[model samples]
Target: MKPILYVGNINYSSWSLRPYIALRWAGIDFDMVEVNLDQPGYGDYAIAEILAFNPAGKVPALRVGAAVIADSLAISEWASETGSSLYPQDPLARALVRSAVAEMHSGFAAVRRDLSMNIRRRCKAFGLPADTVRDIARLDALFAGHRKHAAEGPFLFGQRTVADAFFTPVATRFRTYGIELSADAQAYCDTLLADAAFLAWEQMVLAQPATGFSRANIDRLYT
Candidate 1:
């Protein structure tokens, strides 16, 4: 089966990265189609074509044969079901992983807004809003709980899962924005940055033709 994923710029498109990482991590083969998000025709031209597969007219839509899947959660679920090891075989473990991935999909709105995902652009170090800070603290608590109860290897679940892929872009946002993270979270971020799949993705991102916006600071992320 041929799978095509419509995505945006790698340096900034967190949603695109979610399914991309999930597929790559799970060894699912797919083609990528990039859309110029900064252009004026994004909504009418780029998004309209995307809407043929995804009603939301958004990037990161997954096209599998005649079926179309929109939204990262849906796409990732499809990846898991098809050929990816996005979740665990164990029922309880799979449930735990799904819960974590769902929280990442729906929660952390403040962190997302305050610190946009810019893989290539390092921004001025800024503090988070009160609620976002609270959210980060909550994340730290969650990680700690995982470490205490469910931890096994470098990742939250000892093996890479959809949960890690979901948060991978958030880790990039924290790195780009220079958020002050706790030791556990920082360690987690380091593990993600060092992943071979993520490194390969970063190299592909660097190889893309330069877009004028943020061209000045794009190379810093790879080095």
Candidate 2:
């Protein structure tokens, strides 16, 4: 049976998008349950619905048979086990990929805080916090290094991997907020934006009405 993936709003759920993209890229068959994150009583309702399958009370949880896998990274790892092209074949390359993904999973608080993911909206550029600037520089460096080393393909590691999936939201954030990037970094972002799966997700996101969940502080960074 296909696994069930629980997701939140496509326009704002960055974590949920990771596994969804990974599974789609891997060509894995799966079902999805989209919880209305913008609805009234969403917190309680989402918690209740997710906890029934995953104790973590989070979206992006994958239910396979009787087992529930929580966390986006964990779900991606599980999906990789199904002969998915989520990881590189070389041990060293795989290690680097995992490192990039883990760093993205735990770090980048400043950028995430200042430039929240909102695919449905685009904003004008404005001065960013020092920390956010630093985060963007770091991301540019990461993308540059990967692009330099990749022998083929426009993706970070020569082919799409979990690392690319993890950073996909970052690309969207840069675009949405008009974050300045080095030419190479901008090229990478452009490639991701042009991806068929990413385009499909964007179409779905645009079709949904705005959830009225706006961050005033982040919004101020845009026009």
RMSD of each: 4.0, 2.2
What's model 1's TM-score? 0.86
lDDT at position 193, candidate 1 = 84
Candidate 1 overall lDDT versus native: 0.76
Give the per-residue lDDT of model 2 (tens digit) for 98-157: 999999999999888888888877876667779988999999999987887556889998
Give the best candidate by TM-score. 2
Q: Write the per-residue lDDT of candidate 1 for residues 12-104, one digit (tens) a residue.
A: 788889888888887888998877666544645445556566777788888888978877878887887787567767999889988888888
Highest lDDT model number = 2
Report the poorest 10 consecutive residues by lDDT, candidate 1.
Answer: 214-223
Model 1 ranges with Cα > 4 A deviation: 41-46, 149-151, 209-223
Candidate 2 to native Cα RMSD, angstroms: 2.2
Model 2 residue runs over 4 Å out of place are: 39-46, 214-223
Q: List the residue pairs that clash in candidate 1.
A: none
- In model 2, pairs of residues that clash are none
